[model samples]
Target: MALRDFALLVLVCMLWAGNNIVSKYVVAYLHAPPLFYAAVRFGIVALAVFPWLRSPPRPLWRLLVVSVCMGAGSFAFMFIALKTASPSSAAIVSQLMVPTTTLLSFLLLGERLSARRLFGICLTLVGALAVMWDPAGFDFSGGLAFVLVSVVMGSLGAVLMKQMEGVQPLQFQAWVGWASAAVLIPASLVLEPGGFETVFSIGWRFWAAVTFSAVVVSVFGHTAYYFLIQRYEANLISPLTLMTPLATIGLGVAITNDPFDARMAFGAAVALVGVLIIAMRPNQAMLFLFNLRNRAR
Candidate 1:
């Protein structure tokens, strides 16, 4: 990746990391309904990008599926998870998106991972498991199951996204925001009573969270991410994006007062190293190994 592209991706990670904290605050602390908050956030995104929602792109059905998967399916599952799960735990579990995407790419897209990358994937999984080993609050529960499904939906959406052509991220998100709100607004009314009432009652903190997530994270951050997705192979992009979780961990500690123990630190280190390994091209990794051997000799 070019330096500029890498920097932009890092920016996306930061925005998304901040959203995890803010979204958790709204849902878990301020008692806003999860689905309702998501609906409003998408409402903001839909309005901002409504111009692009004109004619359907080339593949109408596939685009719709991608919209549903990336928008409503993933967002609903994540919001549900955030209802009970810690932000740090949610962030760490979400790194499964990397391995899930790579695996799907191998099966569906016929992409291949080098031996080193496979080991990196395994290492990252180990790190994630380590982080989840907390006895205090990290109990394996239904919330985690929702997050797992969320990762699967996101991974599948990204693979489908790679197959698409001539559809820019702006148009993609416009459709996502529009389609998701269409389904969720009604669903929120049916499933969770008092959703709109809660929205009206909540103050600036809620709106601030909604605006930051909708504008900064979803609109700009995900749009930038999808642009990269369209240009690169899924395996190449997915592992690098794991940087989001690491940033989330830090933000959780600072803002949410999440317990940051030694085990979490070690696990985070392992996961980040795994991400670097996967990010390195095969030849780059080979050269590093060769230099190491020469130094030892």
Candidate 2:
């Protein structure tokens, strides 16, 4: 890749990383309602991307399904998770989407997963469990379930996205933004009483968060990602993008002042290692040897 493109990739990662911190602050500090906040964020994105909605490449049904899964479904659960769970925890759990996507693709799309990938998936699941094993204040009752729901939805969306053809990234994003707004509006009103009024009364910090999510994270971050995906192979891109969760963890610690416990650190390391292995699709024997060497170091 060119230096310019590399720089752009870095910028995209930073935007995504910062989004974790923004989400935590918005839901926790600013007291934004998750569904309502997501609705507004996508509403703005819809408006911003409206012009590109003219000539969509994919079938309307497929596009709509993709939008529903990737936009409304993913954001709804993600916002709920961010509201209650620590940003670091949310970031780590979100990594489950990768393995989930792989498994789903094998089942639904008849895509083949190599033995190495399967092992990586197993490791990732184990790491996820380790991360979730916090004894002191682990609460899986409420919003965390929603986050897991989002992970499943996101995985489905990703697999479907691979089957889609001829859709430009911006066009796809436009569909996602508008469709998410459409679904989220009614859902927010029904699920969250007085949601519209609450959003209107929010302070500028909330608005800033909304703008960052809509413009910077959704627009710039996703756009850069699509650009990289277009330029490079999926395997190459996927491994590097794993850095997003790590970045989020760091940002969560710095911004939200979330505790950086050993469990979180160790689990994140393991999950990330597994993700890199799966994404890179290296030989299992080599990966095992490499892992052993790293441990010895």
Candidate 3:
């Protein structure tokens, strides 16, 4: 990749990393109800992508299922986890998505994994769990469960997405944004009293955070990422995107005062390496050497 594009990828990583901290503030600090907050955020994305909502993407039912799973369901669980969990820990837990997707593929699609991938799966799961054993007040049992559920939802949604065709990134986001808003907005109204008032009373920081998440992260960030996905191998892109979790951990410590110790750091490192292993292409063992040769130029 050119230096300019590499820099762009890093910017996208930063935006995604910052969104975690920003969302924690919205739900935990501001006391915005998690479901309602997610509804509002998705609403913003829905409106932004409404143009693409005119014609339904093919395989409409599958798209709907994927939208609900990945959009409203996954995000609802994440925001709930964010309510009590440190963003750093929650971000670490979310790495389970890579393994979860692999497991799901094996079960649902009968995809066979290499021995290396099976080891990666076990390694990633154990390492992700290890982080929660923090002696600090960051209780993993509570928020960790929610994050795990979110991971499963996201992973399954991705598997379903592989069965899809002709669903561009914008079209997919439009479906997710609109479908999520449709479900979550109503659920929030019924379950969360004063949902509307909270929206009205929020400060500029609140809107800024929401805008950053909905626009910067969802819109520009994913679009640029998809652009790269088209240009490069997914394994190459996946390794680089690990920067998001690393950045999130730093921001969570710096901004949110998240507890971090040697054990947690080691566990995070192990888990990310596992993710890289799982995300590697079939020929990645050889390709890494090739990449090293290319990068030396």
Candidate 4:
């Protein structure tokens, strides 16, 4: 890769990593309601990207469906999980999306999976369980369920995004934001009492979180990701994103003083390894190993 591209890749990683730390602050200190916050964040995105929203190259309905799955479904569940699960745990569970997306593609899209990929998927599942197996943690069952749901929804969205054609990343992101906001608005109103009033009552900290979420995380971070995608293949991009979760775990430990137990460390390592295995194309992995051996020699 060129120096410029490498720098851009690093910048993308930093943006994604910062999102995890920001999410923790939003959920804990800002006291923002997850669904409501999502609604607001996407609302901003929709307006910001309004000019780019044109007739999608693909079927409009398909784009809308994927938008909901990727945007509303994923974000709603993820925010809920973040609220209850520790940041480190949430980060680790998010990696489950890689395996879930692979399995879903194999099932729904008739994508072929090799034996190694299958084994990697199993290992990912086991690692996810290990991450959430704390006996004394707060509501482990509920948190695990929520995080798993988020992973599934996010994975489905990702697979769907692959099937989609003709939508620019920004245009797709605009649709996702608006569609998610549309669904989340009503849900927030019904499920979260005093939703508007609560938002109005919150201090600047909450609004700061909202701004960061809308502008920095959603818009900037995703844009950087799309840029990388344009430059590189998905397999190369996805595995490098394993860094985001690892960064989140580190930030959670340093910033929030969250405990860094043996279980979490082991589980994260195992899960990340599984994710790498699943994401790395066979040829790419082989080449990588070959290069490593050559360098050693």
The lDDT leader among the candidates is: 3
Taking all chains together, the TM-score of candidate 1 against the true structure is 0.85
In order of appearance, the predictions have TM-scores of 0.85, 0.93, 0.92, 0.92
lDDT of 2 by residue, 89-121 (tens): 888877888889999999989998988889878
lDDT of 2 at 279: 79
| Candidate 4 local lDDT, 90-146, one digit each (tens) | 888778888899899998899999987886787777778888776785446546577
Candidate 3 vs. true structure, TM-score: 0.92
lDDT of 1 by residue, 52-166 (tens): 8887787888998888889988998899888778788788777777777888998999999778878778877887788777567655673777888898999899899889888
Instruction: Give the alpha carbon lDDT tens digit for every residue of 20-96 in model 3.
Output: 99999998998888898898789999999889887776778999999999999899999999989889999998999
Model 2, residue 22: displacement in angstroms?
0.7
Angstrom error of the Cα, residue 52, model 4: value is: 1.5
Q: List the residue pairs that clash in candidate 3.
A: none
Minimum summed lDDT over a 10-residue window in model 4 is located at 137-146
Per-residue error for 254 in candidate 3, Å, reads: 0.7
Which wins on lDDT, candidate 2 or candidate 3? 3
RMSD of each: 3.4, 2.0, 3.7, 2.8
Q: CA lDDT of each candidate?
A: 0.83, 0.83, 0.88, 0.80
Number of the predicted model whose TM-score against the real structure is largest: 2
Of the two candidates 1 and 2, the one with more favorable lDDT, higher being better, is: 2
Question: Of the pair 1 and 4, which is ahead by lDDT?
Answer: 1
